[model samples]
Target: MLFVSRAIDKLNDTIATAVSWALLLAVLICAGNALIRYSLNMSSNAWLEIQWYLFAAVFMLASPHTLRRDEHVRIDVVTGRFSRRTQVWLDLLGFVFFLMPVCLVILYYGIPFGLESLRSGEMSSNSGGLIVWPAKLLVAVGFALMILQGVSEMIKRVAYLQGRLDASAFTKHAVTPEEEIAAIKNANHLT
Candidate 1:
């Protein structure tokens, strides 16, 4: 189970890294398109649509990585007061009940939506705009990845509760302010 969890984590990590670059590409495209439209009086619908596609890709694809790193938003004002074990249990419950069901629903609808678009070779209504199916397909892919990451998180939580994994290895979201600062410094190789 742990091995499977690690593999899922690795896959998400790789995808997240690519999505990060995609975000940068999106920004550059947006800026360049605006500059050309205003200065050169030249722009294409495809250029604008590409930016939209990259934005969608970044938001959709990076979600699983966010969940895997425990960086997803939480109503921590109450949960933060709970014991670590209680928190783990709560997280497990959230993954099993809330996260899994929501992802499954999205995937259930999203996959067929994408498939139909692809079957029809759906093009954007805007003149010179990009095809629509890729973005639609990305929605399904993102939710699918989220489901995998959720399973990995649940497995790690169960392992922690069973004392099969160290608390440090299983938990990730409890960094103190000082630890966060130190981490930033270390990441930059600063003294």
Candidate 2:
């Protein structure tokens, strides 16, 4: 079980790194497009098409990584006040009742949609003439990753519920130094 958990953690880390780099590339592409449009007064439809494709790819690819890192937004207004054990129970219930089912649905639909796009050789509707099947395929790939990560999380949560796991065994969320610095800099009273 430990080995399996560790392997999942490694895969999650690799995916996160890849997503991070892809996001950086997306930003660069958008920035370059903006610069060209503003300075040259000439638009490349390809640039616009690439921008949207990158946006879609980044969104899909980063989803599993976000879930793995517990970065997804939640109300947490009530969950924050619960005791640790109670929170564990809530998490278990929520996963079983909500998250898992949603992921399964996405996986089921996204696969066929992506496969159909590939089979039909879908291309961008833009004048840029970009092949869009690859971006479409990212949907299935991302959801599949999310499902794997969800299963891993469910395993850990079940272990916790059964008293076979410690709270520390689960991944914890914390603000990084960069985020801390950004927060400080963005505070209105800081200046």
Candidate 3:
């Protein structure tokens, strides 16, 4: 289970690192396009559309990384009061019962959506824009990654509950400024 979790984490980490560069490239494209349009009186619909595509790609592809890093938003006001073990159980239940089902549904719908786009060779309505199937495919791929990450998280949570893992083994969300400061101090101490 730990091996599976680590592999999933590493995969997401690698993908996230790569997608981050795409984000930077997207920003550069946007800036360059704007400059060309304003300063040189030139721009292409394709360029504009590519900006949106890259934005969507960054958001969709980085989701697993966000989940693995514990950066996804949560309603912590209530959960913060629970014991850590209780929180683990809640996370497990949420992943197994809620997150997993949603991902499956998205994947179910996404495949046909992407296939239809591919079959039609769908292009953006924008002049000279890229094909639509690739973006549609990201929906399925993103959800699949999300589902896999959820399973990895579930395995870790269960292992923790079973006393096979320690509290420090899991990603910890900082609930307060003090916690964040303490974390920085601990990190510094480690070095």
Q: Provide the RMSD of all predictions against the true structure, rounded to 1 decimal.
A: 2.8, 3.9, 3.7
Stretches > 4 Å off in candidate 3: 173-175, 178-191
Cα lDDT for residue 185, model 3?
A: 98
Tens-place lDDT per residue, model 1, 38-72, is: 99999899998999999999999999999888879
Each candidate's TM vs. the true structure?
A: 0.90, 0.84, 0.90
Total colliding residue pairs, candidate 2: 0
Model 2: per-residue Cα lDDT at residue 94: 76
Candidate 1 regions with alpha-carbon error over 4 angstroms: 173-191
lDDT of 3 by residue, 1-191 (tens): 79999899899889889999989999999999999999999989989888887888898889998988777888888998999999999999899899999999999999899889999999998787888888898898889889989988988898999899886766764678998899899999999
Alpha carbon lDDT of each predicted model: 0.92, 0.77, 0.89
TM-score of 3: 0.90
Candidate 1: C-alpha lDDT: 0.92
User: Ranking under TM-score, best-scoring first?
Assistant: 1, 3, 2
lDDT of 2 by residue, 1-191 (tens): 65676577678778777767767787898898889889998878877777777777778777766766666776578788989888877777877888888888988998889899999998877786788788888888877777777777777877888888887767566678999988988895666
